[model samples]
Target: MNNPTNSKNPADVVVIGAGIVGLAHAALAVGRGLTVTVIERDDRAVGASIRNFGHCCITAQSGELYDLAQSSRGHWLYFAERAGFWASEAGALVVARNDVELQVLRELAGRREAGQVTVLRAEETTAQLRTAQGTPDPAILGGAMLRDDLRVDPRTTVGKLAAWLQEQGVDFLWRTSAVGFDDGAVHTNRGTVYGRRTIVCVGHDVDYLFPSVSKEHIVERCTLQMSRAAQPAGLTLGPAVLTATSMLRYDAFTEMPSAIELSRTVDSGLQAIGANVMFTQHPDGSLILGDSHTYQHTAAPFLSENTTDLINAEIGALLGMPLEITERWQGIYASSPNGPLLVKEVQPGVTAVSVTSGVGMTVSFGLAERTLNSLFESVHSHRGSS
Candidate 1:
C-alpha cells in the first residue's frame, strides 16, 4: 500500500523487528551516519531479547561465536552507560560438584586462549558460593570462573536501548508490520516505505516475510522455560552462576575431552529434555533462573511444571538449597541445524538475519556490524564494476 505520509526519500536502511537484532542494526547504521527507520509488529519489544536471562555468556561460546560475543560485549557496555540501564561485568561462575565435572573445568582452563576461564579449588569455589547466601554442595570438587561474561536486566535493557536509539535520531515505526519487500521498498500493512537497504531481524517468525529462505536453511523454533526467585536477605551473587548441568549446554565446555564422561554421569532425563540451570541476580534483588530447550516447527504455548521441577532440583543440588520461585515464563527463538546464526540475502537490497540460537543478546551487535560491513562492501564493489 502507498501512503503520502510515509517518507518520500529512501532512508539509508530500514530494519524490520525491534528486538535486539533489529535494534543492533539500527544503532550501527545510525552510528555510521546512515538514517534508519525500524518497523516492528508490536508496540514494544516483547520477544526473546527481553525474555532471556540477560546473560552475555561470552566465555562459554566457542570458535567464531566466541569472538563475536567478545566484540558484542564492548557494544553492550557502551550502550549501557548512555542508556541508563543496569549492566554488570561481574563475569560468571560455572560450578562443578563431581570429579567428572571438575575434569571438564580443568580441561577448559587449559585452553585459556579460548577465554579467561580459570579453575578454582573446591574450597575456594564453595567459599565463593557461600557469599551469595547459599552453601555449595559438599560434593563440589571445584569450579571455573569465567571472567569475561556480562549480566543485564533483559526486562529493561531492550526498552532502554530502543529509547536511546530514538534519542539518537532513529525512527521507530511501532505497531507496523512489514508484509513483503522488493529491490528498494518494503511493503507493510500500514504503507510502503523505501530504503536503500532493508534488513529483517525477526527472531523466530519466519513465515512473516521469507518463509522459503527459512525453510531452506532448516530454521526451527527453540522453546525454553525460566523463572525468577526472591533473593535471600543479605545475599549478593558475585557473578552469574552455572552448575554442572550447564557444562552439557555450553559449547566451550561440551567440546572438552572430559565432557563426554561428565555428560554420561548426568541424569539421562535432563539430557533428553535439554535442561540446564543458570542463575543471574537482578537489580530488584531477585534471581533469574532457567532453562530447558525443546525444538520443533512451532512451540506449544504452555509451561511444563515437570521441566521446572527438574531445573529447580538440579540448581538446588548446586546451591544446597531450593529457591523460592516468584515468577515463571517461557521464551521461543529461531534455531537452525547449521549453526547459531543465519544471514542470507532474500533479495537484491533485502537481507534476512536470524540468531538461530539463544545467544542473540550475546552476539547481536557483533553480527550487525559484520552484516553491515558486508552489505556496504558489496554495494561499493558493484558500483566500481559497473
Candidate 2:
C-alpha cells in the first residue's frame, strides 16, 4: 500500500484534494521530474471525479476550452497507457431526433475540419446505437460523430492513476485533511507537509478553505443526478451518446446558428429538468446515464426521482429500450457565473485551481499543463535574475 502519512522531506509541489484535478497536477509535476506529495481527506477518491460519465467531452467545447480539451486528449491517452487504465477513443455520437437538432449538427460539422465532426445519416446513426432489436427510434432524424472525444472508467481511473503516481515516487498522504497553507507548507490535520509550491484543488469545497476567492469567482456547487443501469439485452454501445438537450448545454453546439431554433424546438419537459440527456456505456455492459443541472452555494443532498426519470426516460427512448436502474447518485462540481475556471494565486507560492465550469474531466490535464508551465517559467526567470 502507498504511504498514508506525509513524507518528512519537502517536495517540489504539494497538491491538496486527490480528485482528478489534484491527481492531474501531481502527474504533470512528476512528468517534469519534480518531487511531489498529494494530500487527500479520503482513503480513495469518492468525489465528482469518480461520480462522472468519464467522457472527455473534447469536440464539443469552444474557444479557450476547446484548445485546452484538445491538449488534454493527448495527456489522457499518455497517462492511461502508462498507468494501465482503460481508455477508449471511440469518440462521441450526438443524436439528433429532429430537423433543428440535425441542422445544428450540420452547422457544427461544416465549421470543423473534415472527419472531425461527421454529420451522419439516420441509418448510420442507428448503427452506432447498437440496440438489441436492431431498430432505430422513429424520432431519429440524423446525428454527428465527434472524433476527438475519449472515455475512461471514472470509477477506477483515478485509483489506478494514484497508484501509478505512487509507483513513480509521488508521496501520498491519504486521509489527511489540509487545514491551512503557507508559502512552502501545507498544515494538515496530522501535521505540516513542506513543499516549494502548494496547489489547492478541493473542487466544490473551495469555499471551505478559501471563501473569499470562491466568493470572488462566484463559485457555486453544481449538483447533477446520474444513474447506472444494467445493459439492455445485447446493447454494445461504444461512443458516448448525446442528445438535443446536450446540444443546448455544450458551447460548441450552442454557438451553432441553428442552436436558437433547436432550443425553441426542444420539449418543455426536458427544459424543465435542465437535462443534458447523455449516456456512456461501461465495459461491464452497464449504462451510465445522466444528468440534470442545478446550482447552489450549498448543494442539497437529496436526489429527485422526477429529474432522474426525465433523464433516463429520454435516454431509453433514444435507445429504443427501457432501462432497469441499478444505482443512483448525485454528482457535485464547482460552478460559477463568472467563468469556467478559477486559477488564482491565493497567496505567495500557493495557488488555488478549480474548474468552476463542471468540465473538470475534459480539461484536467491541459489546465495542469498550463498551470505548471507558467509556474516553471516564473521559477526559472526568478532564479535567472537572483
Candidate 3:
C-alpha cells in the first residue's frame, strides 16, 4: 500500500485501526503524553463510524454504559459545535406496537429512576412525533419514546474529529493496511513499522487478526440498510429513533412485553428479533432512514437493493409522506458477548480494540479513557520499585 502519511521517525505508539474506537484511543493516548501514529486502509472516514445513523443512544444502554454514553454525548456536543458538525439531541421514541409490548415498556419505566425514562401513551406518542403507523393495539401499545437520544452527522463528525486529531499533534497513516504482527514489529502493507507501543481497533477485520480469539469474541458484521429523503420545508422532528424492539432490548426500558407477547415477538419471523421501525432527521433537509440487520462472515456487501426496499416500505407505511429517495447505503458493525463495544490490551505494549458495534458514536468518548487505562496506565507508571 502507498503510505500517504508516513514518517521516518518511529512513534511511541502505533494504532492499528483509524476507526472511531482507534481514533478515540489515539487521541487519549497522545493526551497522556505518548507519541501516537494511527494507521488505516481507508484514506477517508467511511466505515461504520461514518456509515451508521450516528446515534448517541442514552436510554438503550445498560448501567455503566448509560452513564458513559451520557458523558460521551457531552464531549460530542462540544467538539461538534467547534467543528460545525450537524448535531442534535432530539430525543428518541422507543415505540411499543401492542398491549403486551406496552406492558413491557411500563415495567421498564417503573424500574428506572423518574425522568430517567418517561412512558408515553399512544396519544402522547402521536402528539410528539406527529406521525403514526397503525393505531396501537389496546393490548400492544403505540410505544414509548425516550427524551434523550441525540443524532449527529457521522460523516461530518468523524471527518472533523480526524482533522482535529491531526491538529492536536497525533500522526495518521492512511491507506496503510496491517498485515500481521510478530516479535515487536507490526506487519503492514507499507512493511514493518516499529513502535514503542501499539493498538489495533480493527472492526470486522478482527477475524483475520486473531482467528482463535474470534470464537471467544465473535464479531458478527451486522449489515444495516439506510435511506435518505428530502423533507418538505418546515417539516422537522428533533430526535433520532428506536424501533419497538429497543424498549425490550435496552435495559433502561424495564417494562417490556408480557410473557405472552414477548414470546410471540421472539418467535414470529418478522417480529421475533424485535425488528420494528426507527426514525431520525438531518439538518440538510434530508432524513436518514433505515435499517435492517443481517450477519455475514467477511467483507459483507453493504449496498443491497432488496433489504433497502424492505426498510423503505416500513418507513413509508409508518411516515405517510411522499418521501423523495435520495441516498442509500449499508453499515457493518461489530457485536459480541457481554456487550462491550471496546476492548484494549497493552501487553507487548499493544492495544487492539473494536467498536463497530451499534453504540460506537455514543460510547466512544466514555470508552477512550478505559481503553488507555487498560494499556498505557501500566506502562506509564512512574513509581518503579525503589
Candidate 4:
C-alpha cells in the first residue's frame, strides 16, 4: 500500500466515493495543499449527489446545520468559480398558499435578520411563479424569500468539480470500489492505497463497508422519487420554489409557532407520502420536481407511480398547470433516527462522514472543512505533545 508509483501516490489524504460529499472533501483537501486520492465505485457520480433539486436550502436549516449551510454557501460559490461551474445566488421562494402557511413564512421571516428572509405580498409572490397559463393559484396569500439559498445544476456540478480537482493534481480512481479501511490506508478491489488519513463519504452505502458503524448509528436508506419536467412555454424560474410541505420538512420553518397549524393544514395524502414538494429550474429551463421520503433498512428497487402522481399533482397545482414529466429517478441517501449527520472514527486515522439526512448538497463543503480542521488540529496537537 505504501509503495510509491507516482508523485501523487501515498497521498496526504485518501477519499472514498466520488459523489459531491467525497468530491467536496477532495477539493477542500487540495485547497489545503494536500495530495488527495479519490476512489469511486462508478465512472461518474450517479447517486444522490446528482439526484437533487440543486438547492442549497440554506436559510431553512437551524442550529448547527444552519451554520454549516452558511459556511457551505461560501465554498459552493468559491469552488464554482475555481472550477468554472454554474452556480446561482437565486435564493429560494417559499410559496404560502393559505394563511396558515403564510403565517409560518411570516414567523420564519421575523426570526431571521432583516434581508435574510423577506415576506412577500401575494402579487409579488405570484409574479415570481411565472405561470404559463391564465392565472396563478388563487390560494397564494403571500410568501417569503430565503435570501441566502443557492442553486446549481446537480446533473453537471459533480462532473465539472471532479474534472477541476484532477486538474489541481488530485488523482481520481474511477470504477474503483473501496472494500475496507485500515489506519492510513484504503483497501480497494484493485489495490491498497496509502495516505496519511482516510475519509469515507459513501452516503447510504456506509453499511456496505462498515456494518457495525452503520448499525450503531441506526443508519438506513431514505429513498425519494424525483422527476424532471419539460419547460413550460415562455416560463423561466430563477429561485427554487418550495411549498407548504417544505415547511414541514426543514427544521427552521418547523420550529416556527405556526408550523404545527401549517402541518395540520397540509393534505393528508401529502403527509402520507412524506412529501417535500419543491422544484428548481435547470439552465435548460427544465424544472426538477420532487420528492417524497420513504425510509427503511433496505431500499426497494421500485418507483411508485401513485406517489409520483400525488406529488406532481401538488406541484402542478402550485404552478397552475400540469407538468410534462421528462425523466424520473429514485434518490437514496443515508438516514438515521439518531441525527442528521454521522462523523465517526471507524479506525485510527480513518473517519467516516455521512450526512444521515438529505441536506448533502447543502452542507458537503462545510462538513468537509470541519472534518479536515479536526484531523489537522489533532495531528498538530499530537506532534507537539510528542
Give lDDT for model 1.
0.84
Residues 1-386, candidate 1: write the lDDT tens digits. 22413456788899999999999888878877788999988899999998898899899999989888887888888878877888888999988877898888889889876558888898878776663556768888888889989888999988998999999998888888899888888988888888999999999996557888888888999999998888755557868888877888789988999898976788887877788888888888888889999999988889999998888777777777778898999999999997888798888999998999889988988888889888875432101000
- Sort by lDDT, best first: 2, 4, 1, 3
**Model 4 poorest 10 in a row by lDDT:** 377-386
Query: Which tens-of-lDDT digit does each residue in 31-96 have in candidate 4?
Result: 777889998988999999999899999999999999888888889988888899999999999998
Judging by lDDT against the true structure, name the best candidate.
2
1 against 3, candidate with superior lDDT: 1
Tens digits of per-residue lDDT, candidate 3, 1-386, equal: 45333346767778887777777667667767888787888887678888877778877777777877776666666666655677776777765666666776677677667875677867665544443333322332466556567788776777787788888788777888887775456778877777776778887677677665655666666777777877734555676756554544455543343533564554244353224356577767577886666766664664767656666665555554455788887677777754555463524566667764577777776677666666566645211111
TM-score of each: 0.94, 0.96, 0.83, 0.95
Candidate 3 achieves a global lDDT of 0.66
Reference-based lDDT, residue 30, model 1 = 81
Question: In candidate 3, where is summed lDDT lowest over 10 consecutive residues?
Answer: 131-140
lDDT of each: 0.84, 0.90, 0.66, 0.89
Pairs in steric clash, model 2? none
lDDT of 3 at 144: 59
Q: Model 2, 8-124: lDDT tens per residue?
A: 578899999899999998998888889889999999999999999999999999999998898888889989888999999999999988889999999999999989999999989
Candidate 1 Cα misplacement greater than 4 A, ranges: 1-7, 131-134, 378-386
Error of 3 at 273 (Å): 8.1
